[model samples]
Target: MTWLVTGGAGYIGAHVVRALAAAGIDPVVIDDLSSGHASFVPEGVPFVEGTILDQALVEDTLRTHGVEGVIHVAGFKYAGVSVQRPLHTYEQNVEGTRVVLAAMAAAGVTNIVFSSSAAVYGTPDVPLVTEDLPKRPASPYGESKLIGEWMLRDQGVATAGSSQPLRHTSLRYFNVVGSSDTSIYDSSPHNLFPLVFEALLAGNTPKIFGDDYDTPDGTNVRDYVHVGDIAAAHVVAAQRLAAGEQVEPAYNLGSQNGLSVREIMDAMARVTGIAFEPEISPRRPGDPDRIVATGELAARDLDWANRFSVDDMVRSGWEARRAAG
Candidate 1:
């Protein structure tokens, strides 16, 4: 009943830990605090301070906690930065996943819920991305996430005949926003929500990267899902794996709808009562015109849905960020 949540001190992983705990499952944490806050780990949850890249530490933690499964969420997540620091991304994501699998094999753990990314699809020309889309990762971060999924697949195949075959699933999505808990806010400097919040809090207008994309608002369109919804899906995925139920290799935790940067800016102004036009700048390279996915598979299997509206997402995240100050 005990599960290990890697990077449980981080924004997304911390929400997953809380979700698992609320579901009557014991959750253990192993976070290096590289991009995570120590205070984000709940007071009662058992936490080990270490990196997943360290096989010895990971194995020891798993054995000590009697962890039945692992929710692998630790990694370098900045897509833009990953292009500059590909080595670090691969080491933390690609090689790190391999090490986790090796440790799982050594520790006899047979289940995993991988935190994958929608970036694996690159710039999809389709209206809504599906699970079967051909992967064309545009950045090292995306490439690493795809590789991590592959490792899980190959390991599952290799262990199919064993006493404890691997039960795994990867959940992919873009633009995870909002906060499930006021105490565990998103602290990622690269995320859109936090960046706008930071600018508004500083009495500065937020800048949109570009407003010339082929969309209704001329801003790039992307999927945005609340963090609570994202965390709830992970809990369901873990439970399904634990129950020996049928599961897909990957699922997109996406909102069928897409939102533009201008829409988000409007939401921010409305929610925060900060009425200021967003400054528009030239588009950053590799910025895709549109990328959204269909969460039909996740909706059917993991009971996934976008429970929070754009205003709700903005208010909650803004409140949490302001509370952290």
Candidate 2:
């Protein structure tokens, strides 16, 4: 059973495709290359260049690839930037999800693994957020992701009691850093790992936003999971759905023990051998002091594990970036 991965050329999507291949599952890629690179798609894999907004293209990809399931990852992912581009975010995330579901229904693809976000729980006052938190999304991106989850829920309800009911799950995670393969790395300008690495490479010190936060080291703390672990969990979820095992509507892939910006900077310095203190900048509006969810549920079902340390994340990310050239 081949799985179609939308946005398979992007960093996280590319990693998912690789993990699927490694697990001996066949994967076909469809990427629009809006924020992804063509080179990131593994050689010999079927690559279809198209947007998830194109219902026809998505349906064709599913049919042509003999796909039984989908791992949807395509979206406008930058939360900070999403505030300035709310319309674009909704179009890409909410409308794009609707299009994908429509195509899936048309193609009779009953199973899907959605690449959801931690943004859905923006600025939660609670410590160690659980899967059942009150979703007070602060940005359009988060709201769109929540709306996407709602679409999946409504579809599942609409298709219930069928011979093959829609089996779907969404994974929400924070700070997805590190790389499983050095050939493909995070390139999002909004991500911390890439932004810091790029600044260092350009002979500029990386800046840490908001050092006055009421946390350890006076910086924001977040759950920074390894890309490999994240990909593995996605594959596990897909396998569970294929086996007809019941799954949650949403699962948080996070770390109970999170990392801080200062810790990340220290690791980057040690890994890259570029010892320079990061400049502290004012907090971005709507940025929370700390946001880390509990991965107890994922660890139980999806085999979620934080196998990489902060140093591991920094080293792998740095190696991939320097090697990309």
Candidate 3:
């Protein structure tokens, strides 16, 4: 069966596209290139250059490609930036998802795997977050993701009695790092891995935003999962949806184990052989003490697991970035 992957040329989306191809499923790509690279798309995969916000373009792509399902990965993903650009975030993430669902309904596409975020939970007081935790989004980006999930849920309800009822699942991701393909490195200017790599590549010290959080090492602890594992879960989710297997409305794709900024810095040094200490900057506004989740639900259903260690994660991302340079 064929599946359409929105934002398929992006770092994570590109990895998902490759995974789908490896699994013997035909894949089609639709990306606006706002934060993605066309060169990252593998040769021979059908690609359409456009935004998901365009309902006509999305519906046409789905019908033209004979797509049976859609893996929606396109969105405004920067949480901090979303705070400053709330309107843009809402437009890209919220309105964009609405349009995708509408287009799916129009094209009689019955399945979709949405790309959600951990930011939807905001800063919970608990040590390990689960799927049932209260969603208190702290930023416009987070809020937009939450609204996107709601749209999927409501759409499913609205179409429950239709001949082609919607089947959907939202995978909530934590800190996604590393690289599955050396050709497709994380290029986000806001992500941690690229920030550290760029600083070291420029012969400068990396800076930790905060090192005094109430964690084991007085630094912010986060679940850093490899991008390959993240992509693999998407592939499995697509398969389950295509087969009409039951899936939860949402699944937390987390590592369960949390790593501190200091710990990440240490791994960066060990992997890249850059032996410079990271500067400890004051915490940014609205920074949380910690945010990590358990992937038990995904592990049970999507074959999810954090297979890569901290060192491996750093090494893969570092190597990919260096290779690009």
How high is the CA lDDT of each candidate model? 0.94, 0.92, 0.94
Candidate 1 per-residue lDDT, tens place, 1-325, comes to 9999999999999999999999999999999999999899999999999989899999999999899999999999999999999999999999989999999999999999999999999888898999999999999999999999999999999999999899999999999999988987888889999999999989998999999888998999999999999999999999999999999999999899889999999999999999999998999987888889999999999999999999999999998998898
Error of 3 at 217 (Å): 1.4
* Clash counts for all predictions: 0, 0, 0
Clashing pairs in 3: none
The digit string of per-residue lDDT tens for model 2 on 149-215 reads 9999999998998876789999999889999889999999888899999999999999998999889
| Residue 150 alpha-carbon offset, candidate 3, angstroms | 0.5
Residues 1-325, candidate 3: write the lDDT tens digits: 9999999999999999999999999999999999999999999999999999899999999999899999999999999899899999999999999999999999999999999999999999998999999999999999999999999999999999989999999999878999988999999999999999999999998998887788899889998999999999999999999998999999999889889999999999998887998898889877778888999999999999989999999999988898897
Q: Show pairs that collide, candidate 2.
A: none
> Which candidate would rank higher by lDDT, 1 or 2?
1
